[model samples]
Target: MHLNRALQVTAAASSLLLVSGCGLFSDSTASTAGFNPPNIKMQSELGPAEGQVNLIAWAGYVEDGSNDPKVDWVTPFEKETGCQVKAKVAASSDEMVKLMKTGAYDAVSASGDASLRLIAGGEVAPVNTDLIPNYEDVFFGLKKQSWNSVNGKMYGVPHGRGANLLMYNTKEVSPAPLSWSAVFDDASKYKGHVTAYDSPIYIADAALYLRETRPGLHIQNPYALDQQQFDAAVDLLKAQRANVGEYWSDYLKEISAFKSGDTVIGTTWQVIANLAESEGAKVKAVLPQEGATGWSDTWMLSAKAKHPNCAYKWMNWIISPKVNAEVAEYFGEAPSNIKSCDETSDPAFCDTFHATDENYWKDVAFWTTPIEQCLDGRTDVKCVPYAKWVQAWTEIKG
Candidate 1:
């Protein structure tokens, strides 16, 4: 559940991919045969409300006024569409994929890592953007990408985006660090006070660092790793593990650790850093010069959804400007809808998250599934897939 907030799915999202699994990286429809999506056709026309829509999502995504009475957006949705929202909070992307496979859920707010698996496994269907009136207002950067689409066909509406940042205690750390090396190369300096994200996807952070530090590896993209590149990243993590006081997945535990001074420096998200600071921890977060790993979540429709129309309505309603702003602010991520910037409670919120800055995002490597083919345009060798990454993460943790 803690990972749900920082959300590291087991996917390998790369920043510079122009094509992925028979699909263009973004907006380009061309696909290769090895990466064909399922044969399911998108719904041509939307129909009446089905009265009930079952949803599986990361925590805080489907808030129904239960957690904080003022934080709910679900009640208004139900009244407007006559759709009874039956929401289940999924602990991780893996769980989200498993729940959608059951055919009980109508939709899911899938992160990039899970979205690709759902599309490839045929658990979700291609979305007809025409049926969603609000689709036009969505940020172009969030659409037709490797994670949420196949062969240029979109499978879901983008939910939001956020980056994994480097956090350090201002007083304990001598100087503000500008690169990932603060955790990898100089981890011993911090001794048993460094922290890192606990998930397979975090392997990309190591790979990302090596891509800049070890150009001899010729690592073009962090997610697309040949055997040699993958080994190097794994080795780096194994070494860093010695200095890591703990690997965090839950937000509460991390906040507690930071506030207690048990973790002086480590990987973190903006939300966690904010909470820790509010709790009197002298912490500051930075994106670092090497950029960072991030996630872009999507609202995917289940292929076996029992209430398709209502699910469609929910997707559109959630991404509407006001709603998108609410979700983005409460969830502490950039909104997928461009107009949402204007609706946020704090006018500077959009700038703070770099919500509308395309150039700023070029450095953020969004999470996506790594496949047999290299994501960095290397045709000479096959890149290690996500399964290998999972195995390596377990070994590194052990």
Candidate 2:
């Protein structure tokens, strides 16, 4: 937990970060903020398991001890609930969205980028939290967020979260950087040694920084960007791109770049910093003063779920105290269940990740799919959508 660097790794969220794959929606269908989706009625009550539940998930999420004998959590759930778990490993959110649309699966461990997509498209149903008893133990901060809910109704159960922290080579960064400015306005100081998270969502990091630095810009939420504000953030990133040596999408790539001094400073998750430091990179990761952008992947039930009862059972099982702790530690993220903190093998794990600290996440804008209707709830102006963000990202990179 050095420098309080703790996080999750190698999941759909990780791969989602590397791709510009938030599907495009036209202006007509873009404003999903408060836009009422097709009402897929949630299950009012649970019944006997359907014998099996097919799931689409990130690599490490739905384990069966096949990967690591000691890491299996799914087996016990099957034994307890009598519902067999068949999991498909997805590499990215787009693939997850595609998989969900086919109605081949009952549930998905969706990342922030895809949760809104699923909800807006009516691919997932509203969660009946009343039926899931264990959900009450989940960290209060992880509940009722923009990505996992719509129209004040919950859509999924939060899995875990990790911040996009600022990592700098201790040997190179003089005077110890504090804010995101080192990678933005002062990026020229590092020249080609600077690095950044390689995703269109990265625009939020710039917008987050601008929110603190340029108050007159009146940027309320990083994801809720109007045309002028979005352009400013893009311009800032365009300038930073010049100083950046590489935009890293993989954890190992970032570690290697930092280890070889190819990147002296840039965006990183806690686990990436730990791995890089362990590999002999003089690195330190910190949740900077301006806060950061992060992801809290959710366990969502498909709208067309064939095993509705089993899917509900799996959702409840995954976030149960012990299983939540095991998965959170295994995945390298802060457990969503507050009770899971006590069950974690590392007693200080929750502390390291700020799992229950609402103040810590106050400025940390969890990644949300930006829509035409402003997420910040501005009625007068039409905000940019994810489609435009993707297009702008491609042009900025060019």
Tens digit of per-residue lDDT, candidate 2, span 1-398: 42222343232233223321321111111223556778899899998889999999987899999999999999999999999999999987778989999999999999887888898898999999999999886765677778888766788898989899999999999878999999999999999999988778889899999999999899998999999999999999998889989888878888999999988999998878767888899999998898899999999999999999999999999999899999988878888886776677776677778765666766678888888889888989999888898898898788
Q: Residue-wise lDDT of candidate 1 within 15-48, one digit each (tens)?
A: 1121133222234332322577679989999988
Q: Give the TM-score of candidate 1.
A: 0.91
TM-score of each: 0.91, 0.90
Where in model 2 is the C-alpha error above 4 Å? 1-33
Model 1 residue 75 distance off true place after TM-score fit, in angstroms: 1.1
Model 2, total clashes: 3
Pairs of colliding residues, candidate 2:
7-332, 8-332, 31-373
lDDT of 1 at 382: 88
Clashes of 1: 5
